[model samples]
Target: MPKDALISTQSRHRMTTRIWHWSNALCLLILLMSGLTIFNAHPRLYWGEYGANDDHAWMAVGSSQTMGYLRLGELRIETTGALGNWQDSQGRTQTWAFPGWATIPSHYSLADGRRWHFFFAWIFSVGLALFMVMSLWNRHIQRDLHMRRDQWRPSHIWRSFRAHLDLRVIRQTAGEDYNSIQKMSYIGVIFLLLPLMIFSGLAMSPAMDANWPFLTDLFGGRQSARSLHFIGAFLLLLFFLVHMVMVLLSGPFRQTRSMITGGEGKEPLA
Candidate 1:
């Protein structure tokens, strides 16, 4: 890429978008860490209305008399040292849903975990709502994130998929915008995944159920909502991982600078 070409490129991320992006990133990290800490209280998942120690769980992480295990439905796998059973700082045996390193507070404190989770949950929810409204008002969603009719074509989608596999990122000069795959991903995250995560999180709240029983009904049950919430979190984590990989592969410094300062750098080589 020539110096002139780099200089010619314009802003890739708007100020509001960049603000929301960073804010959301921070909120998500807090939420996920606190959430895992909360999950350590149960370390098991069940379907339908109710579940307890006596009740059958669809998934569980626990240590037996002999070894640690992760039970998924009927299948059980020994996951000692990694998941089910691990030694603590004092050399005490500990069993938790997620490892201590994976959670906030890094120890058993359901109260503290809940407090952190709810505080950030409010921020995440309100921030997301404001961002969406602003995006709509500014036509950011319509002009940049929305998929065009041509993008819906099978051939176009296949081409985009192939390009992604080839790590080919189509560089925009000035007026051009995100590619079809980028548009679809942004749309899915903004409209579908994030909302689902919020709703599922709300559904798990006993207060939410008391005020709006419909949420529990909507998701079939509280336990079902909890399961969905976990699934959504896992999916979001996967998205984050993929996003980071794409950023590194595309152009770490250039892409990061564009987000931070809204100035483009040299195009990344395919």
Candidate 2:
């Protein structure tokens, strides 16, 4: 190999980080996919009409959820079960020890939808917890991805951005494991989007509704929570799109190998 083409192949990351990174990535993919499939079933948008839809109103006035327009054919199989006390369309609240006559929408295989969503969600949550714990424990996040004061400099950021746009920035920047773009994207996806997806999901869960009344308060209502969940999934999908483009631009094999085994080559001799 030529001097400039030294094929450095070594890993600096711990085994656990490598494992969780890919595992979380997979879980995130499934969560986003299935979540999107389900969301597509009910593309309808609704806002809590304070006066007219008062009794069934989900969120307080001024609070809003932007529900997306989903494509058809994502409906799950139809199934029904008893639901506890719930308000009816007439603005009269009724205690239904058994579910009332209501048409519940299923956007995919209802049974499969429930099963896959619940199961995959647990994996997603665990992966997130593990990643977060590992990041803090090793201080890896603080050291590697966090923005230092100097990084905020306009010249530094502009240089980093240009390099990232070309996928050549990482190669040129010294001691910069992640370019500014990478840092911003990873931080936004992992910290903001991931948590938003998880919390919004839980906020929509029936089981959680019983225990955490405030969940409804936080996200507006169950349906509103569902709306937020859809938005969060969309954000994850957006992240995945950019991530794939980056991987492609940067060389999938190179990027995948580095993520799996850490970047090649040990530190140079002093």
Candidate 3:
């Protein structure tokens, strides 16, 4: 008999957890790709453009409002002449000019973008909720990600931080299960990114606004919710990028295969 066979080996994963994990991953990828395509219509951020400003800035689909970012609604309008003058929120008139050689704002179907986003959003939400429920029911959240109070101490955090900064961590645990660094990252995505994305997205919709008036206050305002949505998207994208790198470094095939097959022949422990 193999010597390792003498040691007790507990199952590392469950079918439900494995399914949820891969489902979430797939949905997130779809959402991210579609989101990028939508944002490419107006990839900019702006401040103090919405509401009674000076108190808050605004972020929309584009990088900045000054960029004359194209919107789906105006996608059908073809411009024949120089960009005209537009008014800023402060009641100031400004000329919307673009270099002759530069790309001009192209009109697109706002309805189409909105439809795709809203539809995919439902799948994303379902995946998120299912993942959360399973994680909570199985206590996997606590089991896999939550740090005990002792581990939350300054020394532990500092150790993880130093390992991260020194690049030693990447060398030590490239794949396998999540380390402390990964636990923190996963926690952020599960609690912070998922909730923020859902709530902010809902807050922007009129139907949700009518049902949950306080949501606007929670996020400041509708436009504020829109801003939060964009910010949340950026954070999710960041997580996705890091996650892909970890998978690649740790051995994508095995990691992905394990997720799909629930770890070779490992069975549920309980």
**Candidate that scores best on TM-score:** 1
- Model 2 poorest ten-residue lDDT run: 60-69
The C-alpha lDDT values of all candidates are 0.82, 0.59, 0.60
Q: Tens digits of per-residue lDDT for model 2 on 129-230?
A: 888898877665775678878787889988877776664654444333666667788888879888888887887677887888787668776677676776
Clashing pairs in 2: 74-107, 75-107, 75-108, 76-106, 76-107, 76-108, 76-109, 77-108, 77-110
Model 3 lDDT at residue 37: 46
Query: Model 2 segments beyond 4 Å from truth?
Result: 1-12, 47-107, 170-176, 265-270
Model 1, range 1-270, lDDT digits (tens) per residue?
A: 654334334456667889999999999998999999988899888888788999998988887535688899999988987786887778777777677788887898999999999999999999999999988876678767878899999899888877777644433322245678778888998899999989988888899999999998998899999988888888989989989988877778877887899765334322
CA RMSD of each candidate after superposition: 4.9, 11.6, 9.5
Leading candidate by lDDT: 1
Between candidates 1 and 3, the one scoring higher on lDDT is 1
C-alpha positional error of residue 182 in candidate 1 after TM-score superposition, expressed in Å? 1.9
- The residue-by-residue lDDT of candidate 3 on 87-137, one tens digit each, is 434554433332222221122334554666667678878877887887787
The TM-score of predicted model 2 comes to 0.68
Off by over 4 Å in 1: 1-10, 89-92, 168-176, 265-270
**Which residue pairs show collisions in model 1?**
none
> Could you tell me the TM-score of candidate 3?
0.68
